[model samples]
Target: MTGKLYGVSVGPGDPELITLKGLKAIQSADVVAFPAGKNGKPGMAESIAQTYLQPHQEKLPLELPYVQDPDALTTAWAVATDQLYEHLSRDRRVVFISEGDVSFYSTFTYLMLTLRARDTAIEIQTIPGVCSPLAAAAELGLPLTIWAEKLAVLPLLHNLAELETALDWAETVVLMKVNRYYPQVWQILRSRQLLQNSSVVVRATSNQQKIYADLTNLADLSLSYFSVLIVRRSQQWFNSS
Candidate 1:
């Protein structure tokens, strides 16, 4: 009997936010895997699910470099899949933990895609958890959508073009991974006179969480990589003088 693979979402920052199904998967997994960043440090997903891991369970730290190079990313995914092959061949239950919903801008999707390509018969299950945008919106008391309003969730903003389009097309826009390009993002919003309706949330729902409702201070603020910017195109809930 070949073992199965489980993709578990641990939720955004807060461990208690993890779904019961996700927790059960973590508890029963014989081998636990998480993507270690370029710094080779433990992943946020692992830290969130640490309490659920059994003392004797095996751990796999798959190195995922923080690089935009496609070749490098593909190679890393291949290598990580190769590591999983060894355990799966031996019929060992494996669970991979992801910080947010596995289906949303997560490393687990890459692993699952490669694994399925290698063997189409491979069994995989995914457990969803609270995504960052939802958590951030809750932290700021901002409604993601009202009635028929449209909501767009963009994982990254490489340029201002897409940012402008998002603001124009949707009533609410959630931009994840906005830390690096925040200055530019702020400028674009300020140019369009949309700053008053925008807010930035860092490490939402965590002990280190910070919310910035004033876009004016955004220029001087040093944000974390975990930060997200939510723009209400028409709402003036966060108006700043």
Candidate 2:
């Protein structure tokens, strides 16, 4: 019999944020695979799930390049898929851990695609966890969406014009991977006089978590790679009490 694959979301930053089912999968899996960050650094997913990892489980860190090129991404996913396939071929249960939810802007998505493409009959399961945007909102006591309000969760914005267009009509916008383009985003929000409505959370729910309730005047500030920016068109909904 072939082994099953589990995409376990370890949640954003906080180790305790992992779901019960996710922990069980991690503890019971024969092999645990996580993305190996730049320069062979341990991936965040593995770090978050380290406490639950059993001594008998094999750990596999698959190299994943941090780039936007489709070819590079495909190659990286192929490599990871093959590594996971090695364990599966031996009838060993494999669980690929991921940060945040596996379906949202996660590297596991690409790996899952490649694995399924290789064999459509492969058994795959996803265990959902709390995503960053919601974590940031909860930390700030802000409502992401309410009533008929619209919300947009965008990946790192490269073009200010495109970002302006995307958030112009939406009631709320959650900008993931904001550290790279934060200066530009600050200028855009300032130009639109929406700076006061913007808030930032760095490494939300983690020990290093930092919150910026108002970034109206913060200039040229450097942030960590795990930062997220949330912008509200109107501040009428935030319950700061």
The global C-alpha lDDT for each of the candidates, from Candidate 1 onward, is: 0.87, 0.88
Residue 187's lDDT in candidate 2: 91
Model 2 CA deviation exceeding 4 Å by range: 238-241
**Candidate 1 residue-wise lDDT at 239:** 58
User: Per-residue lDDT of 1-241 in model 2, one digit per residue for the tens?
Assistant: 4899999989999999999999998988999999876655667887788888889889999988888899998888898899999888888899999988888888888888898899898899999999999999999888888889999878977677778887777999889989999888999888888888899999889888999989977967799889999998877754543
**How many clashes does the backbone of model 2 have?**
0
Q: What TM-score should be assigned to candidate 1?
A: 0.94
> Which is the leading candidate under TM-score?
2
Report model 2's TM-score to 2 decimal places.
0.95
Instruction: Output candidate 1 Cα RMSD.
Output: 2.6
| TM-scores for the candidates | 0.94, 0.95
